[model samples]
Target: MKRLKAAVIGCGAIAHNCHLPGFQKNKWCDLIAVADPSTENLKKAHEKFKIEKAYTDPLEMLETERPDAVTVCSPNKYHAEQAIAALNLGCHVLCEKPLCVSMKEANAIKKAADKAGTIFMVAFSNRLYKGNIVAKKALDAGKIGEPFMIRIRFAHEGPSPGWAMSDWFYNPEKAHGGALFDMGIHAIDLAAYYFGKITHINAMVGTLAKKIAMEDNAILQFRFASGKLGYAEVGWTSKQGFAGVEINGSDGALVVDYSDSVQLVTGSTNPSGKRVIRKKVIEKNPTAGGWPIEIDHFVDAIRKNKQPEMGLQAGIDSLRVALGAYDSDKKGKTIVVG
Candidate 1:
C-alpha cells in the first residue's frame, strides 16, 4: 500500500504536541502540509518536521495538496467549515473533540461525511488512554460486574494566553464554552463510553478562575440509558488534585488514574467486623495519551474503508451531552439528552 498523504488544518499547541506527531508516527501516512493563519506557527512546525508546504488558509492547502487524510485541530468555531471542506474533497478526517460548537454543525459535517463515503473519527483521546483501555477490558471481562456508577474528573491549571496559541479560548464566540467544552467534553464522552449513551444531565458552570464570559469550571451529573449514574468534573483552575475515573459495580471496582495506573479495588469485613479495603495494581503509567494510537487508528480505518469506533455519530452523541450540560446550567435544571 502507498503511504497516505496527510495534511493538518490547525498548527496550534495541540497540533504540534499531539496530532502532527501522531500522523507522522504512522508508517501508513506522510506528513505533507500544514495550515495555520499564524505564519509563526507554520514556520515552527516546518522547522521541527521539515514540512515544506504551508498555507495561511486551510481550504487553500486542502485544495492545493489534496491529501488523503485531514486532521482538524482548529478552534471550536472552525471545525465544521474545515471538516466539511475536507470531506467534500473526499478525504478521511480526524477531528478534535467537541466536534463543533453545536449540533447543527455536527449534522452538517455528518452530511458531508456521508456524501464523501470516507472515514470520520473524533479525537476522544481519553478512551485510548492506557489506564482507561486496561480498565475497560477488565470490566468487559467481568472484573467489575454489572457496573452501575462512575466518576471522572479532568482538570488542569487552565489555558492562558501563554498556554494556548491565542486568546481564542477565552472568547465565547470562538470557544463557545470554557473548561466544560475543552476539558469536560472528554469526561462527558468517557462517561458515555463506559456506561452507555447519557440520557440526562444536570450541570453548573462558572467563570471562577478567569475574568472571561464563558465558564472556566464545570460540574455535571449524568444519567445513562442503562439507568446508571455518573458524576464528572472539569476545571481550568486546579493547581493539583487526583484526576481519573472510578467505576463501582456489583463486584469489585476499577480505579483508573489518568496517565498513571489502573487498580482493582475490593472490600471485605474483618473478623472484628471492621471494614477493610484492598487495591491491586494492574497497569502502570503510560508514556502518552491516546494521541499516538488515535492517529494510527484513523489511518488504518481509512485504508480499510471502515469507520473507527469514535465515528461521526459517536462524536455527535458526546457533543450532544456536552452541549446539554450547558443547557442544563442555563435552565437551572436537568436537561434531557437525546
Candidate 2:
C-alpha cells in the first residue's frame, strides 16, 4: 500500500493534539511537512513530530511539497482560503469544524471541493463517537419512535486560561464569533446529524462572563425540516466542562452524557394495564474521542474515491445554522434558514 503524504497547515492546539497525532498514528499516512506563520509553533511542532519540512507560508508549502492530503487547522478566518487552496492543488482536505466564518466562504470552499474531485471532509468529530454511532443506529431502528425534541449543552471554562494556543479566539475578526462558533458548532452539527436540516432558528447570544469582543455564551432553538425541535446551549464561562445531549420521542428517550455514557429508556403498557419502564445503559470506550476515527475515515474516503460522511455540504449546512444563530440574535427574532 502506498502511504498517503500528509501536511498540517496550522500548529495550534487542535493541530498539535489531534490532527498531527492522528496523522502520525495512521499507518497509511506519512506526515511529511507542517506550515505555520509562528516560528515558535513551527519549531515546536517540527521538533515534537519529527517532521522534515516546515514552512511559514502554507501556500508555498502546498506548492513545494504537494502532499496527497492536508489538514487545515488554521484560525477560523483562514479555513476556507487554506482548504480551497489545498483542494485546488489536488489534495484532499480535512478541515476543522465551523468550516468557515461565513456562508460565502463556505460556498467557495464547497465549489473548490466540487471542482477538485478530491475528498473534502469537515472535522465534525462527535459523529465518529461509538456511542453516538450506536445512538444513531438505535434512532434509525426506531427504538425511539418519532424523535421530536432534542437538547444539547456544551460548556467549558474560557479558552484564555487553558488550552487555546493563541489569543485569536477572543478576536471577532479571527474567530468570527465566540462560544457560538467555537463550542456551539459541535452541538449544532450533532443536532443536525441526529435530527435533520434546520429550517428556522431563534437564538440569544451575549458575553456573560468573558470580556471578549464576541458572545461568550449562547442559546439556540431550532426547528428541523423533519419538524423536530432542537435546543442548544454553549458557554465558555462554566466552572467545569459539561457535555450532554437528550432526545425525546413519543415511545422512548435517548440520552448521551458524553462525559460518561449513553442511555435509552423506554416505556410500555402491559396487558394488565400496568406501565412498564426499561432502562439500558451503553458503555462507551473511554479512550475514544473520534479524532483518530475521523482522520482514518478521511483517508479512506480519499483512497476509495467516496464522499466523506461529513462532506463539504455538511460543513456548509452546519455553518448556515451557526450564522443563522448570530443573525437571529442580532435581529432579536427568529430567522428562516435556507
Report the number of the highest-TM-score candidate: 1
True-vs-predicted CA distance for residue 331, candidate 1, Å: 0.9
Residue-level lDDT of model 2, residues 1-338, one tens digit each, is 58999999999898888899889989899999999999999988977898989999999999999999999999899998999899999998999987999888988887888899988899998888887887888888998888899999989887787787877999889998899999888898999999989999999998898777889999999999988799999999998655778888888998887877788988888799998888788656522658767788888898898988788888889899899899999999999995
The lDDT for every candidate, in the order shown, is 0.88, 0.88
TM-score of each: 0.96, 0.95
- Model 1 alpha-carbon drift over 4 Å, by segment: 269-273, 286-289
Model 2 lDDT at residue 309: 71
Error of 1 at 115 (Å): 0.7
> How does candidate 1 fare on TM-score?
0.96
> Residue 216 error for model 1, in Å?
1.1
Clashing pairs in 2: none
